[model samples]
Target: MGFGSYDESEQDNQEYDTDFEDEDGLDAEENAHEGDIEYEFTASNDELLDRLEDIKDNQNT
Candidate 1:
């Protein structure tokens, strides 16, 4: 079979990459912290309590 009629005006008007800048047209800084932030590994009892609280709150909602 052959392709039917099409309308090109329905296509997206903006470019995907350059749409995120400020009014002056510049990319903003990504991270607030200087350099790259690193995560520390440690075991904590707070994890279990926080998880249980989250579950309870979600259930109540």
Candidate 2:
């Protein structure tokens, strides 16, 4: 019964609340977006590959 102590008998007498339903938050369609996205990247394939290699080399140290 001291501070930070554990009791096996107290564990058997405990009741846990299992209710976990909440309708006031987080709807499935709240962030739905319907649109066509278009973009153009000016970086060439070789430039992007060199940058990625540089990042990998930096992380190895």
TM-scores for the candidates: 0.29, 0.74
In candidate 2 the C-alpha lDDT for residue 10 amounts to: 90
lDDT of model number 1 = 0.70
Worst 10 residues of 1 by lDDT: 23-32
In the range 1-61, model 1's lDDT, one tens digit per residue, is 3598656764666456655546665545654466687888574779868888999999999
Candidate 1: deviation at residue 14, Å?
Answer: 79
Model 2's lDDT to the true fold?
0.92
Off by over 4 Å in 2: 1-5, 22-25
Q: In TM-score terms, which candidate is top?
A: 2
lDDT of each: 0.70, 0.92
For model 2, residues 1-61, the per-residue Cα lDDT tens digits are 7999998899999999777688756887889999999989999999999999999999999
